[model samples]
Target: MDTVTHALIGLVLYKSIQTENLSRESKRALLFTAVAGSEIPDIDVVSQLWDRGGEYLMWHRGITHSVFLVPLWALLLAALSWLFWRIFDKRIFWLGMLAVFVHITADIFNPWGTGYWEPFSEMRVAIGTVPIIDLVVWALILAGFLLARFGKKPAHLVFRAVACLIVLQFASQTVQGLAIKESAMSRYDQVVLAADFQPGTYKVIGKKGGQVDIVRTSLWAEPVLLHQLTSAEEADLQPLFEQNPEARTLAKWAPMVVVEDTPQRLAIYDPRFFDRGGSFLFESMEK
Candidate 1:
């Protein structure tokens, strides 16, 4: 998810807490815990500033976003809250854990996944059932914000309702995406699904050997063929990797890539990001 969405999720969490009897200082402390915990995992993004080996892609959502680090982050946020406000409520610790957990879980569902179980596993858990900036989620949270600003109901109740709706939306989208994948299982040796920005729409990528088919479809509609790609699985990519550092990093990061080999150059790009002309992750080396 984007940074703004992550921050908004923290704000929603802060509003959902029952702080009716808490002192002003305690409430402020909880808010700090919620927002800080939600954003702390992304601090690994700073690695790009000092990265000279083209490893920024692997380091950004690496160990810092690990499930093992969640408790450590919560503990740090709780300690900071105590130091800043002198309010030592246990809710501060628990709220920090919840905020950090939500951030990790949300990113797992996005196409740009995080290292959910790092150290134990190196797999990128990208379900691709949710877009990074989901309009439905945005609308639900924005509606909750408006209701809290103007409605007669308590802000906590409104945000709680919004949270439930967001969960329902996520569940519905996941089920549909899984169903689409199941429908294509027999046709392709490997399949990947990417959810469109609009609800109920998806791009189903099916790969068999060197052939790949990208189809745009929905739950109730016929699949529309978008682009058919071919990968040179037998091509020698070592020279490309030797000359292009980004190609080396991309080959390690992407689940699969489409290769283009010609007399002038050897180029490769991730099929997942291919649209219109080409993908930004595309790299080539001249002969």
Candidate 2:
């Protein structure tokens, strides 16, 4: 889910929780909290990519996306938001929770997963069904926002629209996941996707050459066969490394082209979303 989806989701949740019982001020404050909370979880990306480089290793997709941050951020913001909220409604607390959950939920759908249960399992879970910027969901949210803003639509209609978008995205993801699985099977008879990141990206475990081949997808990443760890490849890589160890190092971070029989095979292992060509032997992951 993108910012629009999350923000609209927060608005919908806030509206439902405080349907009819609201002083003008509490209602106003919840709206503020609604929008802010909806956008806040992505603040973790700031700690990851903004100041630092895009490297996922550089404090990216880390604790900020962790489960701990849910309570940590909710508590931190609740007091401040509560002060501004004149109407005392406990429903506001759920609104805060909705905002936080929306952020984390959206995070999981991205290529660089939100590390949802971080500090518990350092897993990067992705649905890979919905493209992060899903047009259908966006159109629905944008229409809902516009409707509420100008049309003065009923709050119930606003809430239903957002829910419909969420459900639509969920359905899309499910279909996409199945499609990828079917496609993976098409390429290899005994293919197994160990982990799928987002929008058709995955970490694949394929049974080939009487062994398990671990295939990783690069950022903006497309899948490629890196190397089969055979005795021949092992022997070849050693001397190759002895000549230019830098190639191995470069391959660790991004794609490296190795031509054979006038055709080339690429190797990629870095966590970048897309490659911006650097001098190292590896090619950029993007098209």
Candidate 3:
């Protein structure tokens, strides 16, 4: 997800933690705890940039942003915090978990997606909807901010409501994303896909004319994922299959491809597919 969304999420989460439902000290702890955890996942980006330069941000998002990595890192962070702040050990653990949960949940909605089953697979699993920095979500942040900044007693109502709405939005995206994936699958004999609700992403890779067709939609700003396939310029995949079993697999993806260069085929499976740091073509509604 985008940084704005991340920061807003932190604000909303911090306000919620400060609610009367929790003790004042606990609330304070939650605020810092959540912020710490939330920003931690992104900590990898610094290293990635340092190591691989800005070019690595794309792939770097996968590792530190992985669900599997979040818990482990948060737990590690919590352990260290517990040891360092022995006086606030209990407070740290409880609020720390909440903080960690917020951090991860926020990322779940992020369209960049995460390696939920990382170390096991490299697939980026999306929570299934919304851009990480959608306008409507930002509005929610404003609402929470206003309530927190000026509302008198018991602003908990607004905070809780905003949090719930955000969570529900992410949940709804997950459902819608699955439906979209199923839709793509139905369109082709086979489809490999992923979805993200926070930044609202839906990407699918399927076969078209024996080539790979990659389609992705941005649920937040745009509504549909468009695709085209182009591969196998002079080769008949079926005839060459026996010589190269691996070729057989790629042969099935010859006709549908964003780009077909030697040893690399671009099977665009996310709305970001069209985003190359410049304005992109948007097929709002297609034939």
Which of the numbered candidates is closest to the native, going by highest TM-score?
1
**Winning model by lDDT:** 1
Q: Please write out the lDDT profile of model 3 over residues 1-287, one tens digit for every residue.
A: 66656766766666664455655555555566666766766666666445422234334555666655655665675676555543354555555556555665566555445655556766555443555556667777787778767987456667778989877776766677766667676677656544533345666666655465556664444545465555444433343344434333332322222323343321212223334532131111111
Lowest-lDDT window of 10 residues in candidate 3? 278-287
Residue 174 displacement in candidate 2 (angstroms): 2.2
TM-score per candidate? 0.96, 0.62, 0.64
**Between candidates 1 and 2, the TM-score winner:** 1
RMSD of each: 1.3, 8.0, 8.1
Report model 3's TM-score to 2 decimal places.
0.64
List candidate 2 segments past 4 Å from native. Answer: 15-21, 48-58, 146-153, 182-287
Deviation in Å, model 2, residue 42 alpha carbon: 1.9
- lDDT of candidate 2 over 156-238, digit per residue (tens): 67767677667776666555555555766655435534234343455544444434344655334566754343212222344
lDDT of each candidate versus the true structure: 0.88, 0.55, 0.54
Enumerate residue pairs that collide in model 1: none
Compared with the true structure, what per-residue lDDT tens digits does model 1 show for residues 1-287?
88988888898899998889989999999999888878889999899899888777778788888999889999999899888988888888899999999999988887778888898987778888888888999999999999999999999999999988988999999999999989998999998888899898988888999998999999899999999988888899999988888888888877778888889989998777779968777989999
Whole-structure CA lDDT of model 1: 0.88
